[model samples]
Target: MSGTGTATGTPTGNESNLESAMQLMIQTFHKYSGNEGDKYTLSRGELKEMLTQELGNYLGNPQDKDAVDKVMGDLDANNDGEVDFTEFIILVGALTVACNDFFQEYHNDDKNDKKGK
Candidate 1:
């Protein structure tokens, strides 16, 4: 998919991987934000649904109300009881960082194994 338009103009598909990722993040946020309440924010139910449908593999047991509540408490930065795009992005950014760390560690382990063999 192509990058999204900035203050300048529509971005072409030839944009960098980071640009495409930014567009995808925007798209994903919108995909789940506007269901029950504010069009730009996610209500608790909407957040739960998004978590279960989009990040089930990573988040696990999204059906667990306690887990969902904990996430909601943590992500509601402004204490508004809802998750805005900025808050949602924080969650995504954190997960991406975690995944990167895991991959780096796994790669290092593989390299060490190869060296030992």
Candidate 2:
């Protein structure tokens, strides 16, 4: 499939796997970013909502104020009490890398188990 953009700002829908993943990331970010304050940034409330709703499984209990506070502090690189798209992307990228590492370790362990049988 050709990975090209149309003049209407819509993707050709023939994007490669990676391209589709990237688009999903953008869409996910915007889905949670523009609820409270700036349309382009995620306020604390918005971030908490997104984390609780979208990443609850990975992040554990979003109702834990301390956990949310730590995450907000860590992700707010500018100390502006808000997370911009770049900051949000960084968080997602870090999580993705960590998940990849976890999967690699699991796969290796499974392979070893099979070999031992």
Candidate 3:
């Protein structure tokens, strides 16, 4: 709706659509870090390397090569390049619209529930 950042710090408009961003991040993370499947945990070096290689298209070419390096440095919670589950969840949650929309798309409510309507 409004292209404004909320008082609680929720970003609206284009910035709020985090699906692409999450997908990009996952793809990039998986690319450099060997996917451990259920056990997949990223190391700092693995995360940093993936960000440089995969996020280039989305994050843009840094004015200086180490620009992204600096960014990733800050985001890495354990000082490891890889973001742990909690950090990743928080980031995605901030970007997602709401829990209703999250489940709505998957449930396809429009096509079903016609037993009542």
Candidate of highest TM-score: 2
How far does residue 96 in candidate 3 sit from its true spot (Å)? 8.8
Candidate 3 segments whose C-alpha is farther than 4 A from its true place: 1-28, 35-39, 62-65, 80-82, 88-117
Candidate 3 residue pairs that clash: 44-80, 44-81
Q: Give me the overall lDDT of model 3.
A: 0.53
Off by over 4 Å in 1: 1-12
Q: Estimate candidate 1's alpha-carbon lDDT, on a 0 to 1 scale.
A: 0.87
Clashing pairs in 1: none
Better of 1 and 2 by TM-score: 2
Backbone clashes under 3 angstroms, per model: 0, 0, 2
Residue lDDT tens for model 2, 1-117: 246474322467788788777777777788888787898999989999989988899888987889888889999999999999899989889989999999999999999999999
